[model samples]
Structures are given as C-alpha cells and as structure tokens.
Target chain A: MNITSDMIYGYTDGMILCCLSEQDSYGYAINNFILEKSGFKYELKEATLYTTFRRLEKQGHVTSYWGNESSGPRRRYYSITQEGRAYLKQRIREWKEIRQLMDAFFIDKKEEETET
Target chain B: MNMEEKIILYINRAFAGSPAAEKTEEAKEALCADLLEKYRGLIEKGHSPEAAYQATISGIGDIFELVDSVTGENREKALPSSSKILPAAESFQKWGPAAVCGIFFLLWLIRFYLAPGLLFASGLPTFLLGAVLGALGMRAFLHRNRLSFAPLLPKEQRPYQLVWGGCGLLFLAALFSRRLNPALWLIPAGAVALHQVISAWIAFSASRKEEDFHE
Candidate 1:
C-alpha cells in the first residue's frame, strides 16, 4: 500500500507478456490471472489494462481475436507473437543478469553492515 | 447517451478514414467497457456522471502513446540516422508535396556558413545526433515510467500538420507565381510547413489507433 503506483505498473507489461506466453486469453481472464497470482497486489486499472492490450497488439508482440462471450461484452482475446516471444526471452535474460549483478553488488554492503 | 456509447464515439476517430471503421467500433466498445465501469464506479462514489466521464476520457491521455510503444514506433524513429541511408530501404519515407518547399531552404549558404564541415562530417554528426535523438525518443516512449505525458498526439499534431502543409503549398505556389512577394510567402510557407509536420503526425496517430482496432 505504501508503494508507488509506478512499481505496480513497472512489472505489468512483463507480467501480461508472460501470461500471454502461456496461451491466448481475453481481457478479463488476464486481469483475473494477475490478481490471483499476485494475491491482489497487482490488480490493474480497467482502463490501464486494456489500453496496454491494445498497445501490445499494435506493437506486433501480440495478436488479438474476438471471443464469443455471451455475457456483458464479447471479450477480445490476445496471444503472443513469435516476435513477442523472442522479445520476452531477451527481457528475461536481461532481468536475470541485472538481478545477479545487483546481488553481487549488494553483498559487500551487506557484509559491511553485519560487521559494523 | 449512455457511458458505453459515449466512450465508443470518443475512440471512433482513432480509425478515421479507414475501411476498418466497424471493427474499430467493436473494439472501442469492448476496450472502453473498462471506462464504462470506471464511470459507474465514479457515479457510485458520488461524483456527478458528467464529471466522472470527463475524468476517465482525459485520464486515458492519448491511447496511441501505449500503441506506439508496443508497435516499435521507437524502432522506426531510432532507425540509425546514418549519414548514408542504405539502398535497400530506398528511402520510402522521405518527401512530400511540402518537401518541394524544403528544397528551397536547402539554401546551402546557411549550412555552408554555419558548418562547412557538416558536409564532410556527415557520418559522425549523424551518429552523435542519432545517439541524442535515440535517448530522447526512448525517454519519450517509456514515459520513462510516468502514467501520462501532459499533451497527446493527433490533438497535438494532425491539425498542426494540415495547416502547415496547406500554407507551405500555398506559399510554394506563390513563390512560383510572379505576383506575390517571395518574402511574404516565406512566413506563410513556413507556418504551413510547420503544419505539414502536424499533418504527418496526425496520420501516424490515426494509423496507430487503427492498429489497435484491427479487423
């Protein structure tokens, strides 16, 4: 609750990309998946979420199709493209490298604090 | 009109002039349902309906920014401003009716007087300039991590381009004509030239909106 909204959204593009990597899913389903996975820490604004879906689809990282929903509105489902998968893999590799570097960088500070 | 209809209309112009108009409508309805829910939530929280609706519309803040980021607009913008553009790309993107007027400004005396080395140093300047542009473009694209930038495209760019292009054309014609003063033509031509940029921008934003509402 004390965290900035930026932190929540910082991970959002990746999270959604990762979810789509599994299979094609509609707007509501993707939102639900995020909510469940994060245990409510990552509930996205409805406007924010769909806007991103539109953006991602436009970028060629993902493709969307209309779903035959019988309820409120027909869902627009999205799935990742091959290009998107490559991009995601690159991001994952980069994230891992960054994380490893951070861990190494922090160890010296951690040891200093412990000794002090 | 209800919240649903209003938001759909709001996004309608996104697909302006395209054959994909109907699909754009459907997508707007589907995508803007999120806005409808927010409208309802606002009404539930005691905000007047109009106020809530306006807030939601304004908050979306140029949906195309998100569109551009995902679509690799940055990639196109960053396409290495090389001094020597390759023969392969064949410069499909250059030139317009307004470009005819830009040729006049090639008034090389200005470039020659300012930096004669620019002719010879093309590659280095291009590389350095590219690095700077790439940085700014990335920052602009990323929002760097902000929710919104104050101004949006189309609204900011389209009309501006049309006006500038129109004036540029008009002045270029006037320059060719023997009647009007070439000097007077420059100011209007310059303004129109400025507007031409806005027009191109409008086209880009419109295309972006169309991409989101794909058939």
Candidate 2:
C-alpha cells in the first residue's frame, strides 16, 4: 500500500526517535533508511524532516552534534535522549491502543456488511 | 551551478534575512551537506543527473516553512536574558544635542542674572544660535537612532511622543517668559531633563521586560 504523508504526519517524531534509538544518525541517513525500509514507498520532505529535528531538539527529545567527516561538509548527527526514549515508549503504547480501537470498529463494520 | 553550489544557494536564499550567527550558519551547512548527499545517492542509484537534481530539489518541500522554523529557533536561542543598554556611542549621539541645548539655556540664564543689560545685547543671539545648532543635531540624532528604538517599546508606547512635544512647548514658554522673569528659563530646561530621564527609564524597563518575556 502506498502510504500518504498524512498517514505518517503524527508519527514522524516517534519514527525519528526510533531511528535514533538504534544509533546516532544524520538527516540524509535517517531519511534513506526510512525510504529503503519502506521499499521506496515513502520519502519524507527535507523541510519537514529538518523542521521536526529542530522541534525535537528544542523540546529536549534529541541532541545533535557535528560529525567529523574526512571529506565534504560536516554532518549534523542526532541522538535520542532519555526523555526521547520515554516519550517514544508512551507514543507506542498510545498508537497500539488507537490501532486496536480502530481495528475493532472496522472489523465489525466489515462483518456487518458481508452479512447483509 | 554544481550540486553543492545549488544546495548552498537554496539554503542561503531561504535564510537570507536571518542573523548570520555561528549556530545558524552551522545549521545551514548541515542542511546543504544533507541535500548534496541525497543528490549523490540518487545519481549513484542509476538515476540521470537531471532526474537526481529534480528529486533532491523537490524533496525540500516548502522552503518558506523551513525558513520560518529555522529562523524561529534562532530567535529563541538568541533572546537575551537581560536587555542591553544602548552602546555609549549611540547613547551619546542621541542625547548630546539635548545636552547642548540645556547648556546654552543655562548660559542664557547666567547672562540674564549677571548682566541684565547684556541679556538681549549678546546673550539672546548666542542662545538662539545654540538653539538652532541643537535643533539640527537633534533631528540628525533621531533619524540615525530610529531603528534602535524598536526594542525599547515592542508593545508600542507612543505617548512618549506627546511627552516630548510637551517639553518643547514648555521650552518655548520659558523663552517667552524671559521678559517677565529670566529665572523662569530654568523651568523648561528642568522639564526637558526630567522628561529625558523618565523616557529613558521607561524605554530601558520596557526593553528589559521584552527580553524577559522572550526568555
């Protein structure tokens, strides 16, 4: 299924936190992973990603530092903080609850339609 | 332009009016690096150079929104914990003319008391000439310091204009009162000095509150 940007809007922060949870990463690397993992079905806007990074950093959900690359311009690497981990866990639990609630309603609706 | 140049150009254009502080420049550099990396990756993945460029540029989404976010972040980071007084040079430039006028008025007062006959003979002319010079200096000072006034009244305390205008009227009144009582000349000078002090205090406090609010 093609995932729309709207579908991922609310979960962008959680996704970034999850990505950083694995290891510290830069903007392009995190986005590349997201794109590849989703089989190229999702590509985030650069502006949105950077804006999210700034917001997350400001909110103390992540911390960033300049990476020492031997060649080319320096990269900004972001790592999830303890607060980010806690926030991600809370968001995951909330997401699960929302999914369960939606599934129950949709499944009941589908069964009723099929019966009719 | 080359990919790196194009990326730098785009980012710079986006953040044109923003303060060129170290953190802001670092952020711009980071963004340029990321975009260039994305472009190179696309080209390596067998995409044509033109297609890669298109993809990378399109991925930037709304440049204005990104600029707003980045600029807002910079502003928050740059907000001072306390308001800084205007620089010595600027403060002097702003107040020097008024001080000159006060001195001239005092000189006029001294002449009036010391040599009553010489008051209009030479004192009036000297005071008038000083007043003209002071007026010209004040006009230039105000013109130069207009932008520096923005932080002083972020909420728009405009009544200061009326206070200043009243001070001018008082000075005129004092000038006319020379016939009745030359000592009355001190009244306008005192009034102007009080107005200057009060207005400066108000501006300083307003600016401090503005800084505190941002903090």
Candidate 3:
C-alpha cells in the first residue's frame, strides 16, 4: 500500500532535522534529497516544507543564513542547532519504542496465530 | 509570461499585504529559488511547458498557512491596517474619552433647552467643556506614561489621535461662541459628522485594498 501524507505528517519535523544533521542545506537540496532517497515515493509541498523551517527556526532548533548562489536568487540554507540534535535524539528513541511495541502487538502475535 | 515571472506573480499575490521584513524576505527569496529550480528540472525531464507550470503551481499547496508562519501570531505589528477588532482594553483606551465627552455634551444640550435658568446658574456648558478637556488631558498623560514603558501604538494609527484632538478644539470653540447665536453649536456638531465621514472613508478604502490583494 502507498503511504499517505497523514501517515507522515507527525514525523516531518524529525525528517527535516535528520536532513540538517547531515549538512547545511537549502530548501531545494533537502527536498530533492528526500525525493531521491525515497525513490520518488514521497514528496512534500513547498509550502509545508517552508512552514516547518520557519517553525523550527522559531523554536531555536534550527538557524538559517542566505547562501551566496551567484545565479538567480540567493538561497536560504538551514543548519541544525545543538538543541535540534538533542530533540532528534529524543524523537528517535521514542520512534524505536513505538516500532518495537507495534512489532510485539502485530508481527509476533500474527506468527503465533499461524503456528497454532 | 515566462515560468519565472508566473511564479513570482503568484507569490506576490499570495503575500500581498505581508510585511517585507528581512527574515520574511529571506524566506520568500529562498522559496522562489527552490521553485524555479524545480520548474527547470521538470522541463529538462521532457514535461510540456504547460504541464510544468501546473506542477509547479500545485506544489505550493495552501500558501496562507505558510505566510502565517512567517508573520507569526503577533501580526498586529506587522499589519497595522489589517481588519482586526481592537481588544477590550485597547478599545477603552481609544474611545473612553470620546464617550465621556459625548455624554456631557448631551446633558448640556438638554439642560440649556429645557432648564435654561439652572443651566445659566450652574454654567453647565462651561462645565461640560472643562470635563471634556480634563478627560482628554488625562488620556494624553496616560498615553505618554504608556509610551515610556512600551511601544503600544503603531505609527500609522497615531493620526487618529490628531483627528480627535482637532475635533475637541472645534467643539470648545463652538461652545464659547454660542452667545453669538444658538446655531453656533452646529459648527462643532458639523465637525463631528465630518470626522466620522472621514474615518469611514479611510476604513472603506483600507478594506478595499485588502480585498484587491486577496483577489
């Protein structure tokens, strides 16, 4: 089944933080990387991506500076702050716990039922 | 229009009345660059120009939410002329003196026409004028105190105080000159009516501009 946007909405902030954790990147680069990494299976709207960037910046989890792109318009690049790293660490731990709980409730139970 | 022009026009329409603050301008410039890159990539991938344009436009999603994030919740400072009802405290700050003056003027009129002897003995008209001036002075003092502590008023809105101050002066002049003829009172009354009309015209034009931008 294809994943719906609703399924990924809650993780957008974490996903963005992960992107910034790798290197300082502009809007187009981050979105393109996500698209390539997902095999073009997922794409986010420009509006949503920018909104998240503003929110994260406001929360002190990210900082931005304009890139010296000589051609066309200058790009605003975002880098994760130390607080962003701490937050991402917490989110990853929580995500792992939830994944483990889901496996216990679904995969293990399904295997047991099949064996019986 | 070219693809770049089309995208810029669309963005301008979306953010018409938003402030051109430095941070906001940076975000907008960044979005424009990204969208242009995406459009170029689509064209390189053999999409028809029309299809590419449509794709780029659709990729923006609901832009109002994005603008809101840039403006934040404290939009009053960013958009002073935005159609927003004043908070109760601010409303009182603006209208309280006018209300007090209005009541006193009404009382003076009733007494002058219906109880002439008592009106003369008590000098009710003079008393009303004094009360109006006193209320206005107190308001000014309070406003000055507030300014020392906080930047409460927007620059664009300060002209309203001048409008009211001129009306108050006209009222006192009319009251003092009423001995020439009872009709002298109409001068101040006419000034009040003129002030209301001017205020309404300003509000109407502002709202029309807001609508034009949104459209």
Q: Give the best candidate by TM-score.
A: 3
Clashing pairs in 1: A59-B70, A59-B71, B160-B195, B161-B195, B161-B198, B161-B199, B164-B192, B164-B195, B165-B196
- Candidates ranked by TM-score, best first? 3, 2, 1
TM-score of each: 0.43, 0.60, 0.65
- Score chain A of each prediction against the true chain A by TM-score and list the results: 0.80, 0.90, 0.89
Top DockQ model: 3
Task: Name the lDDT value of residue A46 in candidate 3.
Answer: 88
Off by over 4 Å in 2: A112-116, B82-215
lDDT of 1 by residue, B1-215 (tens): 56656666676555343333344455556666556655666788898878888876775655665333333443454344432464543432332222333443343434534665665453334434434544454444434233243333444455675666677666645654567654764667578566667668767987897666653
For every prediction, compared with the true complex, DockQ reads 0.14, 0.56, 0.69
For model 2, how many clashes?
Answer: 0
lDDT of 3: 0.77
Report i-RMS for every model. 4.0, 0.7, 0.7
What are the fnat scores of the candidates, in the order listed? 0.16, 0.82, 0.91
- Give per-residue CA lDDT, model 3, range B33-85, as digits (tens): 99888889999999988899899989888888888887674464544431358
Task: Give Cα-based local distance difference scores for all models.
Answer: 0.62, 0.79, 0.77
Q: Provide chain B TM-scores across all predictions.
A: 0.30, 0.39, 0.47
Sorted by DockQ (best first), the order is 3, 2, 1
Could you arrange the candidates by lDDT from highest to lowest? 2, 3, 1
